[model samples]
Target: MEANLTPQQLWDCALRLLSRRDHSRRELAQKLRQRQFDPEWIEQALDRLEQQHWLADSRFAAVQVRQHVLKRHGPLRIRAELQRKGVGPAEIAQALAAEDPDWFELARLCYRARFGPDERLDMKERARRMRYLQARGFAPDHIRYALESADE
Candidate 1:
């Protein structure tokens, strides 16, 4: 169990996890905790990783934002996801800004992909599409634009 493991082993495990992919300190800590690593040891390992520039919330946020954007997820979903991952507000804002996705266009693309660009929807169907885009985390304005101009 944890008694048999040393701090060095925890550190190595942290590095091994990081070598596979970057992780936010909180995420990394949670992972270590799941393995029943000592809380103190986890803190020290996280501090060392931060000091060595190996684990960074900001970097994790950036990668997350890029990946979500590619999946056509909007700002609301992306921000919520970063928050869930324990990314700071400043880092989330910075990463979103860095990506600078054209949310309107992205919404339009999603809408077009779901319903053909030239297709006309009945009132109920239009409402349904609106809800779909809203659930996809688009802003009200962006969803409006997407519906109105998806064909154009």
Candidate 2:
């Protein structure tokens, strides 16, 4: 509710949100504001959480990168998503670098899973497949390797 909230209640709400999943400080702040919590109270609650080490942008970014990679999303899409979540570029870069899954292999797997046997495709068919991979956020080199080098 957007009604009056004691500091404790605000902190409880933030803890509840964090219990479900990691959230950037900005995301937690935005959610509290949306609930009509007083801005000062929101800031206080966030600061307390940070002091308790219950909130961390770096941890949030790391989890996001791993999750997106597992979903077959490429680095570009993952980086953009992290940025949208208010993660700093340095944290995003560190998270991405840490995860560093074999992107080329991932692209190949995604291509195989989506298109099945890489039958000798005509130029038009190849182009269409290439478009699909690109939309999935794969780099051009990875896409080319997947389409050309994947077993027929």
Candidate 3:
């Protein structure tokens, strides 16, 4: 992949990547740069793609949020992940707002699935699970609610 790409070649490569899935402008730019396209070429190609509505950070953020939720991740973790992926704060907020109201329920389901239905973990065990969920980007309130509801 060391060959120099003409402007058209760069554009084609960008489209090939975008056609597979949405990508944040930053993500696409980084990918193009990694392919050794000139910085100027990468910028111009990205601009053209944006003009054609092919690359959209907001769309990428929304899809990422949905996918993370489906994978049993909480809002906190998803938001951080999206931010790290170069999603803007406003788009991240919108994505989080669009997430399911039953997100807490899903987390509870995931917890039960992982630890089994036995809610008899001692205080230390309970705290350890709580810490695990926390590190996974779940809010304390959501984790607490899930643990309590599961106990019931």
Give the number of the best model, judged by TM-score.
Answer: 1
For model 1, what is the error of residue 29's alpha carbon versus the real structure, in angstroms, after optimal superposition?
Answer: 0.6
Off by over 4 Å in 2: 1-3
lDDT of 1: 0.91
- Candidate 3 residues lying further than 4 Å off, grouped into runs, are 1-3
Stretch of 10 with least lDDT, candidate 1: 112-121
Q: Give per-model TM-scores.
A: 0.95, 0.91, 0.91
TM-score, cand. 2: 0.91
CA lDDT of each candidate?
0.91, 0.87, 0.84
Indicate the TM-score of model 1. Answer: 0.95
- Say which candidate scores most in lDDT: 1
Q: lDDT score, residue 12, model 1?
A: 89
Task: Estimate the Cα RMSD of every predicted model relative to the unseen true structure.
Answer: 1.2, 1.7, 1.8
Off by over 4 Å in 1: none
- Residue 18's C-alpha lDDT in candidate 2? 98
Higher-TM-score candidate among 1 and 2? Answer: 1
Error of 2 at 60 (Å): 0.7
Instruction: Tell me model 2's lDDT, rounded to 2 decimals.
Output: 0.87
